[model samples]
Target chain A: MTKRQEHILQIVKDHGPITGEQIAERLHLTRATLRPDLSILTMSGYLDARPRVGYFYAGKQAGTVISERLHKMLVNDYKAVPIVVQENASVYDAIVTLFLEDVGTLYVVNQKGYLAGVVSRKDLLRASLGNKGLEGIPVSIIMTRMPNIVTCAPEESLFMAAKKLIDFQIDSLPVVRPAEEDSRQSELIGRVTKTTIARAFVELGSEPFL
Target chain B: MTKRQEHILQIVKDHGPITGEQIAERLHLTRATLRPDLSILTMSGYLDARPRVGYFYAGKQAGTVISERLHKMLVNDYKAVPIVVQENASVYDAIVTLFLEDVGTLYVVNQKGYLAGVVSRKDLLRASLGNKGLEGIPVSIIMTRMPNIVTCAPEESLFMAAKKLIDFQIDSLPVVRPAEEDSRQSELIGRVTKTTIARAFVELGSEPFL
Candidate 1:
């Protein structure tokens, strides 16, 4: 801002609800000279003006800013490293890997190292309920197979990933990129889970940002 | 915005890199009179000004806005109804309730209807791994007991609840209120889960808000 504008803002902030003529008097300028400044200030959300009340410092609106930042947050920057198991791995081994890695969902990869399926804790627990022992059963049999899995791209917005999680009523989404050898195959790179959204929400509310 | 201010904004947006003098001439206004408006517009992030070149519209910075809206969100507004089980209910019953309700966590309540413990999918999965049959064991034996469970108040900001979820590494928090008979006892009223955070994130990125 120019020195004069800064001086004008200070005056308004300190002695606000003050009239334009009064402000011009202090600055030794005509009200006409201050007209455009006052107009711009009010229009841009820096100050508020009223008929009888004159002008008052109208601070930034608290509920007015959210989507702009959310759109800029991409999945690549926030996705966590995916925990995966071989499609042939037993449900028992998949459960152990889930415990060892401390993740809610496990991506299943085929022998070709492309995404084959996804197994969540709910899926594992449901499988355990069966009379058949978990060790003998392959995760691929119980997992949500390829075409049914909800996946996201690294370039997608984190907001979109979060939306998919909510819409699908699932806990996580694999961040995948098309395989170089075959565009039809998906190679898992990372994951975006509800925990990721929660972490991002916490960061958005943290000190420097607040 | 005043009609004049809107007109000024449109001029800058359409004919940016046009000099202040050129703008003034087109609007049939004196350059000196337009100075304050230009200053205010630049300072408020509506326009970018270059020394020799002139002025250009500077669109809202996408990465600049987030925390304000997050702070406005309250747990009371976003919390989901708590899915709960009796403390003495068998672990097997709790698992059934979890699947029936499609929730990852369940609050365990005492006979008096006060919060006694909390159980998560992880907890149930671990219990299922034990040699002891889930049907024979009470959820109280496997749940995270009282005083150890992280909880939130209905009045707290959703952001704080989300922060607790991340900091404590928990899946969900029981939104509690003091029991009518005893202030020390917590009465479960609602829940805030990572799913809740994910849902809120999606809403923040939805249309109209954007």
Candidate 2:
């Protein structure tokens, strides 16, 4: 269901047997525009309406708005292409890639395009300041390898994926889908970054009501 | 403008000379529910309607959906209370505050509760690893002092404030309202953190669409 529908459901739950015009007024929408949403709710068994009595809440009250949707929003719906580098790429080249993409983290992919490792700005910064030349040194030497690198599947809920970012205190998570034949080997499909979430939040906040 | 009103404006732009019923059908709302939005748009000079000819688009195309709201969304509308400490507090206390709050950064305030400096996890980590006794050292000694601290006013836009966070590569920004008597001192009213933005985005993304 759309957020609007969920909101409408909440309104009906709070004030059952309310008129369409009243719901529209509360939401600053025309009764006409609210019809589709009203129809969906009634048809879905979440709402009940009578010929002259208006609409009434039919859904259970256990589900809150956020939880109702959080479990269903998959990673693939919003994940974006990630900036990646070969594990063999020099630390110097890794730094250049980081600047070019303007991303704090970079996913290191193997030659076959399989998820390999992850490198961050702090890793590069430490490498750059070291007396040792970074010209030919591979990122694999400093990158956080598999089993240590946190990842999420495309099928996973964005809510869980986002929680991982916070729990790990990382800026981004590589979205990987299982290989067609082998479930053990995951292919990097996209990325869910802090910026992506932040931009989404800003858009959400602009709404008159949640 | 609320997202719904924007949608109505967009619908009018894309399919002008459309009746209220048509708009209602397109949005699944009833005519009565959509009246207020239509009225607001018409009065705001964004839309034009005739006696029986239906609504027409009157706004320019260049001024699109986001920019119109971006410029007007004040920080005061979304800012939250900031995690802060006094400059005279020990580095040990600052470290405790950082872990206690589970925040990436901490705002250091003076005796009067004015923002004095900013301390980050990296700062605490470095201080803790040093041989010097953290109890003897004040947070002000290691914190990023004023003139170096990047901040935003409660009057600024979230878009502009968000840009600042990305441009500066920082995790949080202190939301300050300008002082009435002292131009040099700005009162820290709240904070705009990347996590705050992230949580918002996650909520936004969960919605089917605006």
Candidate 3:
């Protein structure tokens, strides 16, 4: 909208049901001059008019505004600190960390501090079954290794991260960046999970509806 | 908007940047008589107007329309069929069911088919650790018992269900209905999990933006 259009909108918003002639009077313009502006404003859904009652502000739709805001939300803004375990860590140790952190998934980093694998509760549970010596078994044996892991980048939209979680049917995503030493190796920076998506959904729902 | 207003909007949408005199002529009405309707249309964001260039349709914002539709989505519409296990089922048996159904959580029901408890992969994992005789222990022994379980109703908004998932820090919710035999007992009808919310989020994001 032009400066004059915005001004006209503000006037109608503040003192709406005011006629085109009255609006023109405030703007120091003729009613004929304001005709196009009024017509444009009404057409764009910024105002409402009634026969003999004049123009009034039509409130901005919350959905459009909120949707735009939502689309701009990035994974970097919402990702949680990732929980990591060494690839050599025992299945027992991974399970302990899982309970202590109360997280559904764990990232397995190799000796170089680059992501090597991802372990979920399901993996640990399946490994634990009928196993008397969980401590002896290396977590790497059960972890979903790199190349098979679904990951997200910090700059990606949270929506995209959420989509990854759904599409991959995984509980969490390692928010990663390329390792300084090896481009093929990922440095786990953070995490996006189903919980993150759920939290975002709640926040969206809780925003004051216009 | 009135029928005449809709008609005017359609006309402007189809042949916009057309003058008010032209629109009035098309409708068989004088320009003066159509002034209020045109003003209303412009103010309400249905059309845009430019001085000398004439009026044109201002497209509807997708966000608001999608948001309204999203808010109307109920759990009943998106809930998935629940996977359940009997209360007396062995923890070993529950583990088999969890893997077989490929579900993160399982609802436990009594012989009468009332919701008895909720079990999750975490719960099963915790029980499996350091235990060799998994079949000896009943799942009910480790399950999060009723009255402590957080649940959702079929009529609840998916947003509300998502809220509960985040707020309570749970993996899934048993979508329940009151049992016919006993009003106090809940009958498992469906399930809502983080996956469900993520799927919904993906769908919302996938919608074509206007």
Model 3 C-alpha lDDT per residue in residues A59-112, reported as the tens digit of each score: 554345445556788999999999999999999999999999999899999999
For model 3, the stretches where C-alpha displacement exceeds 4 angstroms are A1-67, B1-69
Error of 2 at B88 (Å): 17
What's the best-to-worst order under DockQ? 1, 3, 2
Tell me how each candidate scores on DockQ against the true complex.
Answer: 0.29, 0.09, 0.21
Q: What lDDT score is found at residue A48 in candidate 2?
A: 62
Q: State which candidate has the highest DockQ.
A: 1
Off by over 4 Å in 1: A1-64, A130-132, A207-210, B1-65, B130-132, B207-210
Q: Write the per-residue lDDT of candidate 2 for residues A45-105, one digit (tens) a residue.
A: 5676655546765433212333444466678887989999998999878877877777778
lDDT of 2 by residue, B1-210 (tens): 889999998897677657999999999999999999999988765676655657766433222333433455567877878999898999888877876776668899988888899998666655654235778889999999987999998888777777777678787899986677787887889998877666544443355433
- Model 2 ranges with Cα > 4 A deviation: A1-63, A207-210, B1-171, B179-181, B188-190, B199-210
When summed lDDT is taken over every stretch of 10 residues in candidate 3 chain B, the lowest stretch is: B58-67
- Best by TM-score, which number? 1
lDDT of candidate 3 over B84-160, digit per residue (tens): 99999999999999999999999999999889999989889888888888899999999999999999999999988
